[model samples]
Target chain A: MALARWPYDDLFRLFSGQAGPAPRETAGVFPPVNLYDDGSVFLVRTEIPGMDKTSIEVTTAGDQLTIRGERVVAPAEPGASYHRRECDGGQFRRTVTLPQPVDAEAIEATYKNGVLEVRLPRVPERKPRKIAVA
Target chain B: MGTQVQKTEAGTQNPEIQVREKQAVTREPGTWEGPYFEPRVDIYETADALTLMAEVPGAEAEDLQTDLKDNLLTVSAKVARVDPRWKPLYEEYSVGHYLRQFRLGEQIDQAKISANLKDGVLTLTLPKAAAAKPRRIKVTGG
Candidate 1:
């Protein structure tokens, strides 16, 4: 007999009820995500918990961006224990595909408050202009 | 916020117990505690650049420090939990240390990294390097 293995993505899919619209039974997904455009770069932000500053990894490929990290909820020192479990603890992989071609050479990502943010720069374009004298 | 939460190492336990323990474990409203912790953050994107705002309700300027190293952004802050100035019979918020990490992309200019804190909110701005700016290139053909 083999035990089942589950990651945070699976848990998120389950929480989102994407597998089947069963009205998600478990608590909501951890680290909600937000995407925004900064004219120059597209920004993606995610919420992650109990993670060290060193555990996070950010990389990009063409139009795709990925953020991988682990969340260790365990603390070295202890004061009080858990009364409720709203926060999720474990590893998280968040990848975002850009809508258009982006400058892989000029991407940026930042993390704070257990949240990871990635910024992808847009590729420059060329245009034709028409000039006329008044 | 001044309640104590006990850890249950047992394999099988009630879910309600886990939930209550997390909340009652501390005596502060805006503090970080326990193994499973999450912080709500707001990301603001503009044409020029992007700004990340975090709610560190009671954290002071000096207590917070941010660094962007090797494309990884790290934020660490500590709050003094005990102060004898006022006597408190009850507390709903507990102050503790906070540390968070982020993996970054290349768009962030390694040189101009700046951070500012105001009204319990920490804002970090990542500027685009000059080389990355979009510019028109003239084309000539024979």
Candidate 2:
């Protein structure tokens, strides 16, 4: 799938100032996603492990697809202290602009084993007609 | 740590292994220097072993490597590159190598380490050493 660089990435970085050889990828985002286009449809797969199915929401509007979800952080066991807290749980929103015009009604989405996959079929190209001799 | 002297028929030899222990994971913000993304991990401690679950999306099972040496454990995995035919349009997640490490305690049995990858999640089980397990002794009335 054709993915334009998230325009706000640089702006967010400006304030985050987490600059270095490494970028803070998950400082705010919850689920990481992979998007691709194969000349027919744009496919998106996101990793949302241990998330309830009902919390996820997928929507499309004005050539843009938005995925919003919330991941609840599980309560710690009694008398337990965390040694490491790398994973994060909270509400996350990701909106991607479509590379080409697509049939909005033909979109298909599925979630399995904590991975969410969405397929957006491109609208068919119109054939050019030959002009009659004048 | 200095090596212990072992007496043997064929002269004295120092077979004692020298092990360096790193401190346990602490909540020291900004301790991670350099430029590298930290993969998310979940640690579960049980009576038998400590289970570690790391999220390494887009990584293949064969491409992951778990190494342990001198009480320092490292987990690294190579994330497969995207298809060259499709150009990046809008990207929120940067695809690159996944690297994370931990310093295991002496209570762990390094010999029985096990790892498995499924649905982009890597699960590692570090069994506890026999001496680390809790034991109950019977007491008789004196």
With candidate 2 superimposed using the best TM-score fit, by how many Å does residue A33's alpha carbon deviate from the native?
5.1
lDDT of 2 by residue, B1-142 (tens): 9898733235323221111121222333322332234567887666677778776656678878888887788887766555676533334456555677788764889889999876566788888899886678899999
Model 2 misplacement above 4 A: A1-39, A45-56, A72-81, A109-117, A130-134, B1-37, B44-47, B134-142
Task: State which candidate has the highest TM-score.
Answer: 2
Question: Over 4 Å off in model 1, which ranges?
Answer: A1-30, A75-81, A128-134, B1-142
Model 1, A12-110: lDDT tens digits are 664466644212121222233444454556666544433576788887776766666655443312332222233334555555555568888787776
lDDT of 1 by residue, B2-60 (tens): 88965434662321112111122133333444321223345544444555655554456
Best by lDDT: 2
Residue pairs in steric clash, candidate 2? A1-A36, A1-A37, A3-B88, A3-B89, A3-B90, A4-B89, A4-B90, A21-B35, A22-B35
